[model samples]
Each structure stands twice: as C-alpha cells, then as structure tokens.
Target: MTDLIEPDALLFNPFMPGFFEDPYPQYKMLRDEDPVQNHPLGFWFVSRFDDVSALLKAGLSVEVGNLAPGVMMDQLDSLGIEDGKHGVLNMSMLDRDPPDHTRLRSLVTKVFTRRAVAALEPKIVALVDAVLDRMAEKGSFDLVEELAFPLPFAVISEMLGMPPTDHARIRELSGTLVRSLEVVTDEEVARAIVNADIELAAITRDLIEWKRANPGDDLLTALIAAEHEGQVLNGDELVAQVVLLYVAGHETTVNLIANGVNALLRNPDQLALLRERPDLAGNAVEEFLRYDSPVQQTRRITTAPYTLRDKEIPAGTFVLACLGSANRDERFFGADAGELRIDRPEARHQVSFGAGPHHCLGAALARLEGQVAVSRLVQRFPDLAFDGQLEWNGRINLRGPAKFPVRAT
Candidate 1:
C-alpha cells in the first residue's frame, strides 16, 4: 500500500524570513514530503524538478488573456513596480502565450542570437580586464558593488545607447525598482509602486525624447526604427521595452556573477580548476545558473482544473514553481546534487533560465556576462579569498549576495 500524506503536509509557508536565510532545507523537505504542496496564502508550491518542469512545459498555458491584473498587482507590489499597467505592457512577452509571444519575441530575438553574444566575448573580456585592473590596485573590493553589478549594467547601458555619464543614475533607478520586487508589506509595496511609477515613467519619457531627436546605431535606435507589417510601436511601448531590457538584463546578471563568485570561494578546488582552465568558463556559468539561480521562483496561474501527480488543482489557482529547489533535486541530479561541481555532466538540463516559451529573454547576455566575469576574476586575482562574512539580500524570489567582500593577493 502507498504511504498517505497528512493534510498539513500539503502546505508550505514561504513568507517566513528564515526561509530566505537557508531555504534549501525547507525546499528539500517540500520536494520529498510534498511535491505538490499548497500554501495557506493561496498558491500551490511545486518543489520537485519533474513536477515543476511539467507544469512549466505543459500544464498551465500562457496567454495574454490569462494574464491577471490582480496577479500582476501582487507581483508588482512585491517588486515595488509602479508604472501600473504600462509596466505590464512591457512585460507582455512574459505575460502572453503563443501567437502574441511568438510575434513579440521574434522582433527582438535576433539581437540576442548566439552569434551576436559570441561576438561580444572580446568586448566583454576587455571590459572585465579594465574593471579588474582598477580593483587590483585597491587590494580589497566588494564584488557586487565594484565589479559584478557594474559590468553588466555598463554593458546594457552601452547597448541601449545611454551616455556613460548617466550610468550612475540608471543604476540607482534600477536598484530601487529591483528592491521593490522584494517589498512584502502593503505599505512598503505602495511606496515602491509610487516611486517606480514617477521615476521610471519620467526616465522612460526622457529617453524616448532623446532617442527620437538623436538617433544612433544602437538597440534603442533600432527599436525606434523597428516596424512590423506596417505597424510600429508607439513611444509608450518603446520606453517600456527599453526599461525592461535595462533592468532585467543587468539585475539578474548581477546576481549570477555575485552568486557564482561566492560559490567558487566556498569551493577552493573548483575555483582552482576554473582558474587554471578558463575554457571551462562556459560550463562553469551553466553550473552556477543551476547551482544557485538568480531567479529563485516564478508563478503561473491555472486557467483550468488540472491533475498533477494525482493532486487536483482547481482553475484560477496560483502555482509557484520553486526553481531553486527543482534545480538541486537529487532525483534529477544523483546523490551529490547539492555540490558545486564545475564539471557536473548534466548541468545544462537545469531550469535556471526556465523553459518553454517564457524562458528568460536575456539568457544569452547573462551567459556571456557570467563566463566573462567569472573567468576574468579568477585570472585577475589568483589569491582572492573571502575578506568578511557575506551579507545576502533578504528576498524570497531573488537569490544573491548583497555584499561579497574579498581580499586580493
């Protein structure tokens, strides 16, 4: 006879701050004990790799019509997104299902092709070298603030055609917007929403005006010139797209670099392997993505009742896929699943960039940035070691070190 799960085992509360400190244990328990557990806060938590992968690949269909304003409101409130419906429009690619998603994604997909990203390798290496040169003189550095955060931010800023002078301003705005994503309380969420709306809207409007008057051979200019079947995006759409690329491109990459560096410091032998064989940078980036994904969780709502692993999920139910847990699931990754093995044979199968239609649009850029950043850091500072205790940003959805102090030898 099969073992029976208790009614209490069906729920897992993720809101607890303790989970943010070390959620892997809770995630393991959830995966082993209840793969399809529901939360009292009104969402089903899918922890196992297979279950989460199935739901992402097949269960809940993605359609713009199914994009609930309430769900967006909750997400926005959590992230402190304040441009109201305008922000939602910019995120249409992620929110919409096929046809719409297919149409929209095609427009910008060419810009991020593998060849394009590969071409950027030399430029990225140069940038990383420059940043490290400055850091070497200091002998001590905060990786997140000095290198990881700025490198990707600078790259995206250049791609968007933003002037170097405005990089600091853009970074500030992006930081605020990203923090808004983690604000849990209603009051804090409301404040974040208002701040983002006023600031981002103004920034977007200014950029649009500048792009119209002073066109350059850059992504923004390309976006402005882009026309599809005699249809062109208006100023609003252009601004939204720019903001989306600017924030999403750098914010997640920042975490990936920081998290990857931290993981390497914890594993000396793996760090040594990466430092010696920089060619492994590519696989190392994939391993980092799988080992500790920047994006920890993402949600989808069920439009129709579905049976997943014998558990009945009613229509309109919200499902949270714990990617962090799923990535480390032993069932998919053998016994030593938690270890950070740079040569892990099956690392590519991880869903850190997600799967199906809604896969991260910036996946190519992220990988390029990660490989460049990680390889260069090890090469630049051969004796780099943790200088102090790391401080992590207390966020459930986003996983990354807030500050990573290191001493260069």
Candidate 2:
C-alpha cells in the first residue's frame, strides 16, 4: 500500500480514501518526512510525539479551536461564509483561552470533581451489565450501538440528572452535533450541524429551567447553583456548559470503548494477556487510549510566535496537534510503537486525553467507563471476536467503528 502513494503526499487529505481507512502509515511518513509541515489550507500539522507533547504543555499560549480570529476569519472567508459563532463556541472551555476558560472550568469543576465521578462506579458497573445483558439476548450484536454508545450516554445523562423521558432526544441531538466534526464535503452535514446546535441550545435552555424549578443532586443542578467569587454562570453560559458536557461526554467514551474493543480483538496476544491478568485492566485501558485515540487531532491557535521543531510559527496560526500520530510515534513508544501491547510501561504517557490545563475535563469519567466496559467484555465473553465486516465512522478527527459486529460465547 505504501508503494502506491506518492512519497511526498501529505496524509491529511480528507478526501483520500486510503488515508481514512488506515492513516498510521501516512502519519509515520509525516513524522519522518515533515514533522511540522504547515498545511496549504492554513494550519501547522505537528505529528511527532515530542513536538505534540511540547505544544500541549504550552498552555494558554496555544488556544484550542480553529475559530481563533485571524486565521479562522481567513478560513471562513475562504469557505465563502460570513461571521463567527462565538456565542455557542465560547461556552465550551475546550475552545476558550484563559480567563474565560479558567472561570468556566472552575465553575464546572465544582460539580464534576474526581469524588463525584468516583461515586458513579457502581452505577457505571450496573449500566455496563445492563448493556451487556441486552447484547447477550441477541447473541450477536453491534458492540458500538448496544454497549459503547449507550453505556456512556446513559451514565453521563444520569449524572446530569436529565429526565429519562428526554434521554433519547438528548442523545440523538448530541450524536448529530458530534457527527458534524466529520470530514464531509456535502452541505447536508453543515446544515445538520447548524440545526443540531440550535436544537441543543434550546434543549439545554429548557433543562436549565427544569433544574432550577426542581433541583436534584445532579451535575446540572449543581452547575445551576455553582458560583466562584460570587459570580455565577449566566443563562447562555449555563446552556453552553451543558452542551459542552453533552457533546464531549457522549462521543469520546463511545469511541474509546468501541476503539478499545477493536484494538483488543485485533491484538489477540494483548487480549490474552489482559484476560489472564484482569488486574491489568487499568493499564490495558491506557494502551487502548494510546493505540487508537478517540479524539485523533486537536486544534491549538498560536497566540504568539512560537518555535517548534526548529520551525518558527507566527501568531494566529492554527496548529493541529495530531494526537493519533503522536501516540504511535516510534520515538516515544519505541520501534514496536505500531503494535498493541497491554503491558507497555509508558502507555500512561499518552496524550489521548491531552495534557495541561486545557486537557479533557471528563478524563476521569471516560477512563473509568473504558476500564469497566473493556474489562467486563473480556471476562464475560471468553470467545468474543468480530462477527462481521467492521464499519469505520469515516471521520478524520474521531476514529471508531460505527458498527462493530461481535459474537460473544
């Protein structure tokens, strides 16, 4: 396959079918040939492990989101679009810089603490069991639809104290919004994204009102009352925060479990190793994160001129930190980086959940969900294996099987 492609071809061509199915080969080429290549479309692609790690630690100097004013405006112009969506975009700390980001994160931290997350273990376990039971009834199932998607979606929704009656609607809306991140050439996706954003905004607004009237011991209720320095989140802020949680919490863990299961099935040795020592479940989860990262790449805009790998990147430039490529970079994980090894000592060093202040806020919850789901699947179904052709989600940024058929004996 490597022989068929041009030696200098950049792996980021969204339309390239070969790159979408298996991008690691192209990523390896980028790491070796041009670790810090700037895209003609206007962004720096950082593929090497060391370079990605350094950029992550750069903190607020490198902000998240492609909508940063200068280059982002240029991008919009190039697309023949007008204006920006700051109202909705600013709500997510994942896309904000310091001050606003810090304040929003602090407000959210009051509710989404480690203890709060830890307390959900039993609930998560039960949810996992319930999901598996449904899968068992079928004997054969789409692991993603039955277990991966539902488990985390249910857990996160319950944590938010959303009414059970609205769970299906919220889940559907969140899925639509997340799918907007895919590399689609059609205007249908764009229209869907815009509509989903509008619908999510309305749904969250109503949820906030409901929580205000009937407060419960849930994250949403806590978020409603949460304040820092006597400053509380406004209505828009509240809606945005809820939407952020819904989007982030839903997709990442779904892909994590789905991707992890696929990795385990593909690497029988590691699966056997995990099956023998279930104690390695935690370590194995980390490897799954590194092996097939849920969130492939994250955007960071340069606030100031920054030097990375001897290349001086100017301010306002959008830099894509390729977490997927970095995770497989041979320099960090050694020559056997391409292979899945559950016992890899340095697997935790992976930036799958990212690093520094702007790192994923729901990392703890996602990790817990991944650990329980993957471990339970291995233990309960001793002969678990792929039952049919795997269907990739076809998203360049979020890689996972859309329909992973598996047989559990």
Candidate 3:
C-alpha cells in the first residue's frame, strides 16, 4: 500500500528560514503534487510552468492589491500599517490596473527601449571596470557589497542625474523602502518603511524641483518633458515612478550579479566552461536566471473565475505564481532542471523577467548588465572562488546572497 500523506505536507509556505536556505526541493514537490496549491493565507500558489505562464498572461488579471476590492488606505489604517506615514502606494503605477497601468507605462516606455539601454552600455562597462579595479587592489572583497550592490545603484542614479555624493543616501532610503514590499506583514517593518518613505519623499521632492529648473539631458529631465497624447505624468506620478525605477533597477541587477556569481562558484564545471568560452556569458545569464531567479514570485488577482488542474479559483482571489518553481519544472526544462548548464538551449524560456503586458521594462538593461558583469568577473579573476561561507539574504520574495565573500586568487 502507498504511504499515507501528512495533511500539512501539501501546504507551501516560504516564510521560514529553512525555506530561504533552500527552496528548490520543496518547489519540486509542489510542482509534482499540487501544481495549483492554495495557501492558508488566502491565495493560490501556481507552480507549474504552463499554469504560471497562463495565469500571468490572462488579460483580465488585476494587481494583487486589488484582490481585497476596497480602499487599500482604509485597510492600512485598520491594520495600523503606517509605512512611513505616506500615501505613495496608492499613487504608484506598480499597484494600479488597466487604464492607469497603460497610461503610466506609456509615459516611460521611450526611456527604457532597447536602443536607449544600449546607449548606456559604455557607461555601464566603465562603472564595472572601476569596481573591478578596486577589487584587484585588495585581491578580495564581499562581492555583493563591493561590486553587485553599488554598480547598479551608481548606474541608475547617474541616469537620473543624481550626484555621486548622494548615491549612498539614496541607497539607504531605497533599501528601507523596498522592505515594505516583502515585509509589510510585520508591524515593526511597517514602521521602518514609513520612515524610509518620509525620507525618500523629501529627497525626491528636492530632485524633482532641481530637474524642473535645470532641464538637463538626464533621464529625470527627459521624463519631465515626456508626454503621451499631450498628457504628462503629474508631479506625484513622476516621483513615484522615479522611486520605483531607481529601487527596482538596483534590486534585481544586484541580485542577478551576486546570484549568478554564486551559482557559478557552486558549479565548478560550469564555471570552467564559462572561463574557457567567455562567449557563453549571455546564455549563462539566462541559465543563472533559470537556476535561481532574483524575483521568486509575483502576485496577481483573478478578475474572473479561472480553472487550473481541475481547481476552480473565484474572481478576486489572490494568486501567487511561483516563478522560481516554474523555471525549474522538468517538463519544460527537461530532466536536468536542477543542474547549472551554461549552454542550456532553452535558457531564454525562463520567465525571470516575467511576461505579458506588464513584463519588466528594464529586462534588456538587466540582461546587458548581467552579461557584462559575469563575463568581466570571470576574465578579471580566473582563480576566483569562495573565501568564506555564503549568507542568504532571508528575503522570501527575492532570492540572493546577502554577503558573498570571494578571493581574487
């Protein structure tokens, strides 16, 4: 007779420390057993590649925040969730749906186009080189702190015409602000987010006024001038979008460089292959994204009833599509889903950048950054390897190393 299953075995929760350390095995189990598992927290977790893809591509889908179907500010007040005593969230395009999302995205689409991102490649390479030179002097460093974190922050800030001196302050504000997305459920964290938001708003207001007066060639000035059908982003929208872009740009690319390096270190053979064939750096990035994505999951709300694997989900139900799990599904990626293959043929198939109308706007920039960072790191330190134990960031929504110590031996 088959072994009896535990009732709680099917429940998938990623909040635990153990899950942060390693979530793949559990992800596999979820994909194999309950591809459309429902969580006790009142959301469906979709793990299979096909199902996750379908749900994300669903035209009637709404932002996860809309799942509650009421004024979010009222909910925040009821829960005492004072995230920096600000009303910024409601003004954010990231949390909006339909006409609002369409309008906001259109305002900045020109700025994020592939051609625009390509024009910034020379600057990105110079920034990467400067960091690598500093690492070469020490012959060792915390990869995340010294290289991964600062590089993207510097690039994004430069694009906004932010002075290099203000980069550190912006980083601090961004770090605290992003936590609201991942840890808003915790009361203590909610308050920290509030402080960050207050500080961020002050800084952003100053910058907006400066850009308005100066009207330089930077992205901030360009955004200030950009309009769609003669409709431009208001002051609030501009600040919200700038904050979103600055934070989102750093968060993912930082993780990508750190996570991609960590993955290469773990798989020696793949590392060696990359060292020998630097041309594969582009493909290797895709593989790294597939193996351990930066963004683990994205939430959406059903606008209409939907069915998956015989499970019926009602309208307004929050759904969490497990992007990390779906990327490793054996059916789509073949049996070697767990291994790091630099030349994996279908690496681009991974949904690390997400999909559909709301797909990541910075996807191309992220790819270029990853390819350059990884390729140059291998070239700079052929003998690079772990210098100490790796530290997981403990973020349930985003996956990456908190501190990755490496030696340039």
Candidate 4:
C-alpha cells in the first residue's frame, strides 16, 4: 500500500476530531493506504491484518527501555517523568520483554485456562442473572452502570478475595490509570496518570499485606503462594501483577459486554437474529470483539532491524500494531469486513486480545463473561432497545461507551 499522507502531513493524529467516538473510518484509511505507516513522530504503525499479526508474534521487544531516543520518550522526559518512577505501571508483565514476561505470565496462566474458566461458569451465570434481575425491576437502566462495569468489577474483586472498600474510588482510579496506555501529550493528564498510579499502587500494597496475613482460596492468595525458580514474586513484582489484574480483569470484559450490546442495538437485524439464535452467543462474543475491539492498539520496540513490505524498519524503532484495524481488514475479513455479522466465521480470527507472547491471559474469562452477560440480557429482555444517547468513553486505546442507556419491556 502507498502512504497517503504526504511528508509534513501527519499520517496519524489520534487527536483528530471525532476520532475517539468511532475510530473505524480512520483505521480503515490507514489499513487501505498506509498499511505500514511511518509516522512523522519517528514511530511506525502496522494496520494490515497480515503485518499486524506477524508483528505481534515476531518476538520483538515490548520493553520501552529498548526504544531508542525518539518522540515518545522525549515527550515523557519533557513531562518531568523520571525513568523507573512509575513502579506499579513499569514492573508489570505488560511492559516486560522475553524472560520476565514469560516468568510472570507462567505464574497465573493456569487460573485463566479454558477449563479453569469453565469451573467458574456457574459463578458467572449467577452474577449475570443477578444483575439482570435487578435491571428487570427497573425496566430501564444505564447498561454500563447497572451491568457492564459492575459485573466484571465485582467478579475481579471476588476472585482476588478483596475486602469491601469504596468501589467508586477504585473505579475512578482504574479509569484514570488506563490513560497510561495511551499517547499522553498533555501535562496535566500526565501528572494525573502518575498520581493515580501511585495512589492505586499504595492501595494494592496494603491489599497484598492483608492477603499475605489472611491467605485464602483466591487469586491474590494464590499469587502470594506461587513460586517460580525457587523464588517468589517480590514486593514490587507482586504489586504490579495485582494492579495489572485489577485493571485487565474487569476493563476488558466491561468493554466487551457494553460494546457488544451497543453493536446489537445499532444493527437491529443482527440483534433480532441474535434473539432468535441464542446458540450464537459464543460466536457473537467474537464478533463483538472484532466489530469493536476493547484494546485497540499494542506497541513493540524493535530490538533489531525488521523489514516488512520491502521497507526496512531499523532497530529500536517503536511500532504500534493497530489491532482494531487488522480486525477490520478487508483483505482478511472479506468485502463486508466493515459490517457486524454475528455468525461471521472469521470473527474469532480478530486480534482483539492480541496474539503471541503477550496475548491477554484473561481472554477466556473475558469471553465467558461476555457470552453469559450478553446472551442472558437479550434472552431475558425481549424488548431491549436504546433508552437514550450513547456516550463514548473518550479513549483511543480502549473503545467503549461510557453511558449506555437501554429500555426493555
């Protein structure tokens, strides 16, 4: 594909108006025009399905420390940020490369397997039904508030055996901290992210000590007990992992349920079809992920010179793998790639949870949660429809509605 944006013309400006509410058009432009976009900011973006898929499993470096002096790093430095200062964010497996990522992922992979998630199915079903029961009485409610957010939040809290606290505070902190994953260019936003990470880290530290003292049959307790190579996860590592869980555990599923339902409502034909064929629940979740991925883009810093489509990308180059675009690529998903088809066979091929080494550990859990939550809601509420205007979450990386009002008879 030929680059569309001329030199001095920015190929990707995430701040482009209306980009957040619906990034698909922009993503399509990138995929069709500059499949391997070299941004003026000194980084690259791979939007085509084949390239994005290959890049994820290419064994490239994910560690920011491996990045050469570039625009992103310079921006961070200008924000008065010191290296290794964001301990809670920096130490997680999400940012690690190779051996460290492997070690950290190994510690928790067993708990998120298909069979493990199956064991938790009853709990998920019960949770979904319970929320639906409450919504049943109201007849109309904000789906995001009443179900989407709380279900995953409560599930993760229960899984970790966390004590009751201010749920709103945690939600607020979690939302703020997610901006760390985006391209933060504002000074105030950067400071807010740094502050939020610190506060959340403190809360996690206290939670860890409490869990250590009062261990039980839960993920946190299990992490406390887990050992690798005769060495247990230390203080900093423990905090990072727990925080990562708290965020990833709920964030991904919340988007799935909310975005999935929103998609169904928008495409009434598909929604009616889903209502008729509830068996498509599992496949429906995959379509939801592909139609509108929760986590849109993932980054990797090249540890060595890499060549793609005849262009040689040098070592230490930062690359943003556009997962959302790849999921919608016409070359891979056929001519109607833009449309939401619930039964699409290639839906599961979407790279929403990503692929390769850092693919989301909580994917199976998220899928199960989404399948149950979305399926039961449609089944329970025969007249499910939009109640009011939808509000986008204003995030470029994680796309979902902030407020999803719906009414059902």
Query: Which of the numbered candidates is closest to the native, going by highest TM-score?
Result: 4
Q: Give the per-residue lDDT digits (tens) of candidate 4, residues 98-127.
A: 688887888877554567667788998999
TM for candidate 2 is 0.91
Of 3 and 4, the candidate ranking higher by TM-score: 4
TM-scores vs. true structure, each candidate: 0.88, 0.91, 0.92, 0.93
Which digits, one per residue and each the tens of the lDDT, describe model 1 over residues 1-409? 0022233343455454466667787788888888897655556789889988888886365542323222244454556343444443335466556565676677667555677667777888899998899889999989998988889988887777775456666677676666544323455544554466457757777886787798886777777667433354543555666777888888789889999998999999999999888878889998998888898887677888977898998988767788999999999998888899998879989898878667888888898899888888898788999999898877667788887899995
lDDT of each: 0.75, 0.80, 0.80, 0.84
> Which window of 10 residues has the lowest lDDT sum in candidate 1?
1-10
Tens-place lDDT digits, model 3, residues 216-287:
777877787784335667657878888888888898889889989999999999999999998899899999
Stronger candidate by TM-score (2 vs 4): 4
> Per-residue error at 85 for model 3, in Å?
5.7
* Candidate 3 stretches greater than 4 Å from native: 1-8, 66-85, 227-229
How far out, in Å, is residue 397 in model 4?
0.4
